[model samples]
Target: MRKILVVGAGQSGLQLALGLQSHGYEVTLMSNRTADEIRSGRVMSTQCMFHTALQHERDLQLNFWESQAPKIEGLGVSVAAPGSWAEGPAARAIDWVGKLDGYAQSVDQRVKMAGWMETFAQRGGQLVIHGAAVSDLDYFSRTYDLVLVSAGKGELVSMFGRDASRSPYGEPQRALAVSYVHGLGPRPEHPDYDAVRCNLVPGVGELFIMPTLTTSGRADILFWEGIPGGPLDVFNGVKDPAEHLSLTLELMERFTPWEYARATKVELTDGGGTLVGRYAPTVRNPVGRLPGGGLVLGVADVVVANDPITGQGSNSASKCAASYLASILERGEKEFDEEWMRGTFDRYWDAAQHVTKWTNAMLAPPPEHILNLIGAAGQLQPAADRFANAFNDPADFENFFYEPGKTAAYLASLS
Candidate 1:
């Protein structure tokens, strides 16, 4: 059996390790936290999985929360009126819902990652609980036939040099804050709240509200993607979950009053339910070199670290794992050298590049064409549905979303 070392037991690393183990490869997964620690630790991300990504997990028999998690049946987009931003219902502008072709779901990473880690161990995969750094990669590279890094952040990630040609942004795209809370009442006007509600305050930032399954139970997640130095970028110095929750509510009241009204009764689910940070959308070279001169391959966020603005980080990670798994399986005793690594990464990049493009487009100020598309989506059910479903396959977005001519033609057809 070919031995493989997967550093970082995150979505991609764990998934690939388990997949290789099932295929009779000797797989050792190194994690910084054990399953118990992961379960009891702070929240990791606002991971809402659409159909394609969820299906990838199901195919790997990893969808443990499918039965218990709330089904996200649609997506809602609201654009708040400029200058009308205040603490009341009058601050709203236009709101509309778009039905999805299939449901999406958000399972808190604490629940999902811990469950996955335990399952990996139960299935006889070798698991190590230790932090890994670039200094250790030289030894790891010699020990395993192939080494794959998938951790999203930290010193290990810095080992993979930024590919400036592919990476457009030089600094953090948004100041991100997320709070998971319970006790949120259903929207009074639209009580059937089984959708990912995205409120865009053009020029300010965006807010995403979703039903998420947490360690405690079903709850709501409010994620703020604040443009740096903007009004929504107010999470600095807030460490306590209650304070985080209160600040989120205050921000909502100031920008999205409709959502604020619904969040009036909400409280942080736990001390670990809130997080604040920032990351530039970056694409790094897939192969990293150690000081001792060994090369290790990077997968998922190690190579493509998009801001969670478009909710594509985890989804892209899953796709990368699936693609890399296929490539590795097909290698069939061939050397896992630089050429093989580059080829594998290129295959994954074909799919990932679209996600990066679409996500970056969303981070920028909406062009007139995109505004027109959103308007059409509000009025036309088919347009709305198509737009929502595109989230499932971001690659398809290139056909319409980023191209002004295609978007105009699409809108013309919608009429």
Candidate 2:
């Protein structure tokens, strides 16, 4: 292999570049700008790389946290329905997404991504600061031996062309609002204050709060969701950034009433919020093989894992990279075309579908099993804990993505 050209320099792209380079493959990472742009204290999307993602990093020995990054200890997950009590022994709590003192670490992926890219460059990997440019590649010409497209953006979908059967996605794409803010005006701390949280508030959507080591020294992140073209888009008519944060804080106070009872009210400070308006697309075929040789494909959030309800965006790509890398290393460039990409991705597709479908299923009117299950938990205390922990247990984790039946079975065991 002469050199692998990787498109898109996001988290997924960085991971693939590191993996390939570590395996002694020649790799050139091309992005809109140099890694220095990413290192300029900008955080794009917030991702909780749970233990699995961290293990992948450690396994590759890709650590850049000596000076700036902070290590995350754990995650607190609470699943609450709107208007429900969120505190006390009587209220229900969801399972923690990570094991105690485990490998899950919260990171400003933008910074860490740049650090890894710098490391890649130091290790002799080529860095190309080309913006939206790629030489047309045809395998017969044998231009690069292998061209891996990790492009996580929307336009990349058309690259592999289109296929009907394997790529049927029925859901429409939706816009989301994500912001990292600070000094949200201050709330008194609770007696038992546990920071670093992930929450799912029914009807109101999800928000993940993580501790960040930034210029402000310590900052928090808030990920908010709004219906496309809805009132929230214009910050519900608020004109300025502080006003927007105020509106979000206002809404948060109203909706997070349950959490507000115990958790500290966010104190918003001016100029501390950075908002990214994102449109996430749904995809059943994020991974597709091109018709010719010298090409293999994998889609991360880059391609379309917009189903953030499942948090598979980053993890899916990491797993996909591992799978795609394996496929390429096994079959070599000539054999690593669309077909083999399909074969390796089949495993990823099956795993992701099982969990995401179940997750998205929860958003709508509840299914009978869910109703019965939640109803059962309400009636039987132990059953609820067991049922909710389905998102955490190792067996539940494995089966959640790999075997829905097994996940169902684990839940059934408690009943």
Candidate 3:
């Protein structure tokens, strides 16, 4: 029997661990903290998981299958002028988000992580608390057939191999302040307002509002986005995040629903709804080889890419876990040697590179004509929907990555 050890209990690690167990591998998953330690109701960032992502999750039989995950109503996207962010061409996306087979909406990340860990253990998976820290990590034995690392935190980055991209994305961490509110008005007037309201402000960054089902019977709004000089940084000295948050929302009110009027009280997690800062640091393609890789493999955020802006982190992580598990099952421990594991690492990187490239390119500043094109497309219905779903298509992904042909296609297909 091959003994596999999975480090880091984040979503990626959890998915990989559960996947390996299902394939009849002797897997032991050890996370650094307990479930309650990480649980919090703060932000909503991801759209529904992609169809390919959902299928892999089901094939692996991840724990949250029966849990209350979202059935995405649709995507909420906006395109506005560079300076005037408050008002712009708004687009509502339902056909894509709402119709995704298994997952169109979202489940809380904290909940899913906790749920997966529990289920993995219930079905005879091993888990431990307080495993190896990245810097202090050193493999004791090659006894364990394979060791997979999927730590999302920064500490995990140093414990991996090199990146191999021409001009990989930069390391820019932004501060985001989020809060859940009740007693808000009806959804906005945007076309897909019934599904999701995406506020796209070029200079100000992004703000996404989604209705998520927590344990609470009533639907709650998760207000979230990353700001350059966000409240957490500018008001770092304030010492009261609740107050800072209230002010932040007030300043950015023009883009959101008219809900600020009814926010009676705010429930702050981590003592004030202050998240331990988030980053979208980019590096070259995952290293084909690490210094001392007897058989330690990279998974999810740790390997392929990092950045929640594209909302591909979680989906990519889930898919990577499946692919990683499949590889291990096909080839036993012997295949995990430094050379072989390097190949697996390369395979993982190759799979994620195209999507990462596409997202990174789109995130960069656009030219004059392209901006106008996006503005025009945002004004229409079908064009906007196709623009959003194109992310799920590889041809579109490549088009977006290499050229503006896809955007041109959107122009030609306008309603």
Candidate 4:
């Protein structure tokens, strides 16, 4: 069996490691924390997995929480005018709902990662509970037939140089804050409660109210994407979970009254259910060189870290793992050299490029054409459905989302 070392036990690393082991490869998965530690640790991300990503997990038999997780059946968008953010939801200029082709779901990373780590061990895959650095990877490269880095944090990720040509932003597009709470009541407009509530405050930032499964049970995840140095960038130095919950409620009252109304009695689901941080959306080279001159392949966020503005981080990671797994399986005893690694990354990039572009566009101020598209969606069911379903396979967005001409034509056809 070919020996493989996967550094990082994230969505991509764990998934890839398990997949390889299923195929009879010798896989060693390294994680900084053990399963118990992960379960008790702070929240990792606001990971809302759409249909395609969830299907990938199901195919690998890794969808353990599928039956328990809350189903997001549709997407509801509300656009507030500039100063009208302080007003009530009645002041919103546009409000609409777009039905997804299939449901999406969010599983808290604390619960998901811990469960996946345990599953990996149960499946006979080796699990190492030690943090790895660049120097560590240099040594690992020589011992393993193939070394794949999937951890997106710390010095290990810095080993992969930024690909400036592919990376458009030099700094973080938004200051992100997320809190998982259980006391949120259903939105008055949709009391049945099965949709992602997206609120866009023009020139300020965006807010997403997502249904998620936490360690305790089902809850709502309130995510704030605040434009840096803007009014909504108010989550600095918030260490207490209760304080964080309070601040989130305050922000909601200031920007999204409809959501605020529902979140009036909200409280953090657990001590580890709140997180605040910022990250520049970046694209790094696929291969990293060690201090000792060994090359290791990069996968998922190690190569592409997009801001969660479009909720694409976990989805992108899932797709990357699936693509890389197929490439590795087809190699069939061939050397996993730099050429093979770059080719594999390129294959994943073909699809990831669209996600990056679409996500970046969502982070920036919308152009007139894009605004028109959103406006049209409010009146047209087909346009709304297409926009909602785009989250599933972002690659299809190139056909009608990026080009103003294509968007106009698509809108016209729906009339």
Model 2, 1-415: lDDT tens digits are 5467777777678888889998889998877767767666445665655556556666777655523444554444555554453342123344333323343445666567777788889999988876542224344226565566676654445655433443344542233445555543222332233245556555445555655644344556666554445433445343466665556555455545444443345553224345555443455454444445335464555444545544446666666676666666777646455566577667656655555555445445444455444445444555544433443222354443234465456556665
Worst-scoring 10-residue span by lDDT in model 1: 85-94
Question: Which clashing pairs does model 2 show?
Answer: 152-302, 152-303, 183-267, 183-268, 183-269, 184-267, 184-268, 185-267, 185-268, 289-338
Instruction: Give the CA lDDT, 0 to 100, for residue 367 in model 3.
Output: 61
**Model 3 quality (TM-score):** 0.81
**Candidate 2 segments whose C-alpha is farther than 4 A from its true place:** 66-103, 133-142, 161-175, 183-198, 213-217, 227-240, 258-273, 278-280, 284-296, 302-304, 332-334, 368-415
Tens digits of per-residue lDDT for model 4 on 175-291? 989998999898776677589988998888989989999999999999999999998798889788888888888877877887787888888888998899998889999999898
Pairs of residues clashing in candidate 4? none
Which residue pairs of candidate 1 clash?
none
Counting clashing residue pairs in each candidate, in order, gives 0, 10, 4, 0
What's the ranking of the predictions by lDDT, best on top? 4, 1, 3, 2
* Model 1: per-residue Cα lDDT over 1-415, one tens digit each: 8999999887889889888988999989999999999988889998888998888889988888899999999888989887676444436566788888889999898898898889989988889998988888788888889999988778888788999998889999899999999998876646765989899997889999999999999999999999999988989888778888888888888888888888888888888899999988899999998888888999999999899988887888888899999999999999999999999999999999888888888888889888888877878888888889988898878778877999999888878
Number of the top candidate by lDDT?
A: 4
Candidate 1 overall lDDT versus native: 0.88
